[model samples]
Target: MQFTQLKVLAVSGSLRKSSLNRLSLESMKLLTPTGVEFLIYDKLDQLPFFNPDLKNNPTIEVLNWRKSLKQANLVIFARPEYAHGITGVIKNALNWIVSSGELLGKPISLPNLSPRASIAHAQLSEILSVMGGDILESCSPNASLITPYVIPCDTAKNLCDIAVINHRIRELWNRIETAMITK
Candidate 1:
C-alpha cells in the first residue's frame, strides 16, 4: 500500500475527559491531507499491564490493540506530563506495544501539550526512541488547550501553533508515501 493512502493511528496518553493531548491528536486527524486516515484509540485505560507471565494468555482487548498497531502505517502520540514526566498510563501502554514487534522501524511523532516543556518532552523523546520507535518530530504547546493550567490566554494563538504541528504531520505522511513508492 502507498503511504499517501495509508492509515495512521493516533493514541493520546492522557485519559482525562477534556485532555489537551487528546484534543491535539483529534486536531491532527481533522487536518490530515486527503487519502490519509487517522484513527484514535480511546481505550488506553483498558489495556492491562505488560507482563511476560500473561503474554500467552493475553486478553482479547490486548490482542486487538496489537493488531491495530500492526495494521497502522504510522503512529502519532500526543502525551501530557505528570510530575515532570510522561504519565504512568502512557508509559505502560508503550510497554505493552514494545513486546508486539510491530513498532520496530515504524514512523512516529510525539507532539505534546504540557506546561513543563523542556524536561518532559526531552525525556519522552529519548524513551520512545530507545524503545525502537522512530521519533520523527515533537512540539509543545505554549499555552494550555484546556483550562486551569493556563500559560497563556489566546485561543487563536494556540490554534495557530496547532496549524504548524499539523504541517509537520503531513510532512511525515509524505515521507511515508515516498517510501511506499520505492518499496
Candidate 2:
C-alpha cells in the first residue's frame, strides 16, 4: 500500500511560548518525511472548559478542535505534567472531544520528554484508552531512554540528543505512513 499524504496533528499540553513540550513538537515539524503533513495544534488555550450541556451547541473553538482531530490520520501529543498528571489544557481539550467521539478509534502517540513523568504518561494513556483511542506504542518514544547521553528536560538546552530526536520523529512519520497505507 502506498500513501500520497499522511496527516498528523501534534498537540501540546503546555501553553507557554517557550515550553519544552511545545518546542520539541515544533522542531519535529521540520524533520517530517516527504508527503507527510504535520500540523502543530497551538490552540489548547483557546478552547473553553468542557460542559456536557454544550456538546450539542459547541463553540467555534470546540468545532475547530474536533475538525482537526477528525481530519488527521493520527494524533501526537507532546505534553508536560503538572502535579504528576497531564496539564489542565490537554485534559480540558480531551474533555471537550470525549462526548463527541473525535478520538474514537483514532491512533494516538503521547511521547514524554522526562523519565520522571511516567505517572503523567500513564494517566494520559489510561484516559486516551478510555476515550477509544488506539494508543500507538511505537510512536511514544521516551527521549531520555532513547539516548543514554541525553539528559532529561532539566535544562532548556539539553533536552535530548539530536540523533534521538531525529530517530523519534522519523519513527513517528514511518508509523503515520504505514497506518495511512494500510488504511
Candidate 3:
C-alpha cells in the first residue's frame, strides 16, 4: 500500500522558458503526492544529435540524459504541437535512447495538451510505444481547455485548471500503484 523511491522525470518538447507546456510541467510538480519526487529535465539543448558513432563513446551530457531516464520510475512528457508533429528537441532526445533500450518496460505518462496538440501526442505515443514504453492512458491528461495561467485570480474558474493537472497526476499515481500490486 506504500511506495517509496518514486521519481517522475518530466520532459517538455518546448525549449522556451515561457512555453505553456513547460509551465504546465512546473505546475504538475506542485501537485505530486507525498514521497513522489517530480523533476523536469531542462538540459535537452545540451544533448547532441543521435549518432551511432557517439553511442560507442557518448559525451557527458548524453550520459547524464540516459542516466536520468534510467533513474526515473515514470517519465512524463508535456509536448506542444509544432507543425502537427513532435518537437525536434524531444525527438532528438528520444532518438538518443531508442537504440540503447533504457526505457524498455518503463512507464511513461504522455499528457496530451489537446485541441491544438492531439496529432503531436498521437505521434509521440506511437514512437514511445515502438521503443517499448508502457504509456499510461489514465495519466494522459487532455489539457486542451486549461490555459497555463498561474497568478492571483478572483474567480474560482481560473484556479480550477490547476485542479485538472492535479487530477491527471492523481490518476497516474493510483494506476501505477494498482499495476504494481497486481504484478
Residue 3 in model 2: shift from native, Å? 4.8
**Can you give the lDDT of residue 111 in candidate 2?**
82
Q: Per-residue alpha-carbon lDDT of model 1 for 28-103, expressed as tens digits?
A: 6655667777799888799888787888788887888888888887787777777788778878777776666767
A best-first ranking of the candidates according to their TM-score comes to: 2, 3, 1
Cα lDDT tens digits for candidate 3, 115-149 = 67778988999999999998888667565445522
* All models, RMSD in angstroms: 5.3, 3.3, 4.0
Question: Highest lDDT among the candidates is held by which one?
Answer: 2
Clashing pairs in 2: none
Q: Which model is ahead, 1 or 3, in terms of TM-score?
A: 3
How far out, in Å, is residue 20 in model 3?
Answer: 1.5
Q: Which pairs clash in model 3?
A: none
TM-score of each: 0.74, 0.85, 0.83
Q: TM-score for model 3?
A: 0.83
Candidate 2: RMSD over Cα atoms? 3.3
